[model samples]
Target: MKTKHPYRLGVDLGGTKIETILLDPEGGSLGRERTATPRDPDGPTEYARIRDRVHTLIEAALGKVPHGHACTIGIGIPGTINAQTGRVQNANTTGLIGHPFQQDLETRLGRPIAMENDANCFTLAEARQGAAKGYDLVFGIILGTGCGGGISINGKIHSGRHLIAGEWGHFSVDPEGARCYCGNRGCVETKISGGGVAQSFFERTGQRLTLEEITEGYRQGDPQCRSAFEQFLDDFGRCLGGLISVLDPDAVVLGGGVSNIDELYTLGVEQVRRYAFHERIQTPILKHQLGDSAGVIGAAWIGK
Candidate 1:
């Protein structure tokens, strides 16, 4: 008799959203659920909210699990995660600081769980099952809140010497540029992140507008909005050009809120090609197909 393979659960915990997905070993999403991330300024309040929201989402996903059996769980956290301690180091989620997130979740679910940075997970998912499926080298980028990146070789994450080989967003692109939330000046994130794009628009037009507003303005051919959007595209292309020079990966996949813009891939490819030192090679910039689910879906394969 053959032993049955266990089911798998993938969870993505972000400051703004929490997503959970159940999947089979073949990378198929069985069931998924998402909810707004609760805001709790106080430590205790935040922890309680996290616990409650996680439970609710997981329970909902569990009800949809296709198999009759339970499975192992994996989580992608949006911060500096210490796998050994399961503690979230520095991150936007202040309430989760120093919390043994993996351990606590394991206790609640009655199973061991794997955890890693969400960007890393997303990269793996894209490389293994999404747009970069056939590539040997894949880089995934998250251009929101701050920039986050992940690298995969041969469909596996290369954590590198310190498990940080994929943190490319923190790479400084301009030392004298705007100050970043990470206390660094002119980091690529400060120039190309979702917040950065909005801030740039505000600076140029003196109007506090949503990204959607900016997009609409661009679509309507507003000069100020067009300028901001075009600048963002150009800068984004320059960044990708630099990445291509360094990693020279087969393809790059983009995720996060900003990726919702239709022109990013097209404009980015043009810019990257223009700025890239290697004039003979053609590098493709692929849009993320999995969207928000990529993190959770990729996390499910952690340690597998």
Candidate 2:
């Protein structure tokens, strides 16, 4: 996007961490910082802390700018803002669920702020300059602490009327599968997310294993890990395949820590084809080129 400001500041409010990134017009990172997201049991107090943390980060970024240069501010969160009530909704960070985050932040900073879903920011970053750069219609999927999806066309986000356009993770593919935080059984997140698979493995194996350990055990031929990993991959295929059948995006870019797994492109895509409706699955399931920086950079652009 062509913007008047030479500097852009972006923040990503994730379930585990809150990060801020400063970018030049050329997309070079100027500065960045990350802090653990406050999860105090007191919801209102924690919300205030998160808001102040974001304010602190943005203030630091603004300090780096020259005296006369202006900058745009954008924030990407795990949830979308409810248009009617103007509050956060459907966020994994439960403290942010019903807060007027945007309004509060803008009031604190005394300026306008562009806020969007972190998944949408990821897709927009990918579609513009990451792995899905050349694609016209891109589906950016996050399989991290949770599963989320976003749509980007020509590098612009399509949030739809209710601002939940690409929310396929909540769609229950299994009625009797597992209960989700949203009170639904067998949602896609319950099947493919790192947290989901780990929880499922714990429930079945009576042991706790990190997602990486499970995949490593799968490679090492451990019986329990193999069984759980195989099931996880199957769920990944089924859920992603169903999404592909519906959206049919020109390209699908995988982000989040779980995307680091090599099998999602090979074994996972193969299963996607098996589950997808079309005989010829020409859609490319590509890895993200930007790594963890996509969401923050996307936030910067979305502010324009």
Candidate 3:
């Protein structure tokens, strides 16, 4: 189990929060922490804040590795990342897109650094050490603020010829349905992500509720909440069905807030079966076992 490299660091950057973890070469977590993401309120200010935050988290995580130990750093950013250039492209955050994040961090931290999309990191984590561990082909889906995904094969991400292999959530399921953050209409994401879930809840119940509140209400057996949740499951299943048809992966792992629903895995699997191609071969839909930590851990796995 010995590796050629020493211990490393993983950082998961989100719009609202960032998590940093110290990871041994064998994928064991030594320490971790979470901090709020910097919000600049404007473009330039936000960029400075994010760079500062990234440096802070990396330093904090690196501090845990003792005074003299050397380590590499990997980051899981939630957006379109130019892997070759380490440039981030997304609408939700500014000052980060196309930033020379890896080089700047390397200079500041005195260690090698790598970067990839957050969902891609999630896929790597699951494929290497979590729910999809034994599988050669794994796809990790994130159904959160915006739907996103990552594809890994044999512990490596299949970033496609265009570096966008696992963008399943953005795939247009209904070109004429609802608008998506990616500037598309009827993307599977727009109908099944956290925002989508809240929007659907509001439409169905004539009440405005955040995604957490709605899920909690459903757990508590509120009839309207339950109904709304069921609808979410239906949409999720349809999306999975489509994905299964295309990827036909050994397993499909679900993460993000919605996956935490008590029986969501069971419900989604059953629903996907209705639309899947392999009646003789049932594919499993599993809830991600790594929780939110997957991104950080997976980030440490960049270029592994």
Candidate 4:
């Protein structure tokens, strides 16, 4: 029999795209949709364009459900909601900052909803059903265009007291390193992110190379590429090893484009062992099973 009520709808509000998915009670996808996030040149308010787009996406997702079934909405944003003001804060999408996003979205949808940072959604998904399933403490890391992280304890997100518990990307790895947009020097993101690796290669070789090119060159034994790749591994080891020292998670599941590099599981794991406080690093560092779908699926679970 079909689930009578409390269907789940998830929306991943990413920097460039908005994706929505409908999930049945069994956690199977009923429908999914994706669209470019709307940009408004004439709108007076920044959040208005994106807000309208999200509303449209939600409506479209709901339409895919069986008759008489309505889904509870859960949204994953690139930033966190401020506990004090209930506004979006620390989003790279500047327009979303300071906007009363949750309230505005709730009003437009005419229902209660759940919202969380995208990284948290990724972590939750992994812990609940993806690579980290059955793990008590899971740490999920995203090393894509930028770096970010999230933590899940017993299948539930641990947002922490200040709501920034798993924000490992901004942690300063080098005090004298490059200046970050977050106004910090040598953040973990500035060293291990795909963009960061590319930037580092350019600075050293003065040849602009995409992350794919760098990895390919590394595979082909290019010295400059090898140097960049090794640097990334070192940074990854130190940063992640440091985090493991503190959190000691059951598993560390990696997502994002950079995670595709097989070296992370091999050489990167060795480096982590070297730097980790423990004599023997038994923690398993695994790749994400759900790939890009983790965020959206996790969002649905949040609503559930």
Candidate 4 structure, TM-score to reference: 0.95
What's the TM-score of each model vs. the native?
0.87, 0.93, 0.87, 0.95
Candidate 4 structure quality by residue, lDDT tens digits, 1-304? 6565578999999988889998886777888989987755446665788988898888888777778766788999999999888999998667788899889978887788999999999999989989899999999999998998999998899998888889999999899998888999999999999988888788888999988899899899999888888888988999999999999999999999998999999999999999999999899999999999999999998883
TM-score of 3: 0.87
Worst 10 residues of 1 by lDDT: 1-10
Q: For every candidate structure, what is the RMSD over all alpha carbons to the true structure, in angstroms?
A: 2.8, 2.2, 2.9, 1.9
Off by over 4 Å in 1: 1-4, 52-70, 83-86, 107-111
Displacement of the residue 209 alpha carbon in candidate 2, Å? 2.2
Q: Order the candidates by TM-score, highest first — what do you get?
A: 4, 2, 3, 1
Give Cα distance to truth, residue 43, candidate 3, Å. 4.2
lDDT (Cα, 0-100) at 173 in candidate 1: 86
Cα deviation of 223, candidate 2, in Å:
2.5
Q: How far does residue 173 in candidate 1 sit from its true spot (Å)?
A: 0.9
lDDT of 2 at 18: 85
Give the clashing pairs for model 2. Answer: none
Return the lDDT, model 4, position 158.
Answer: 92
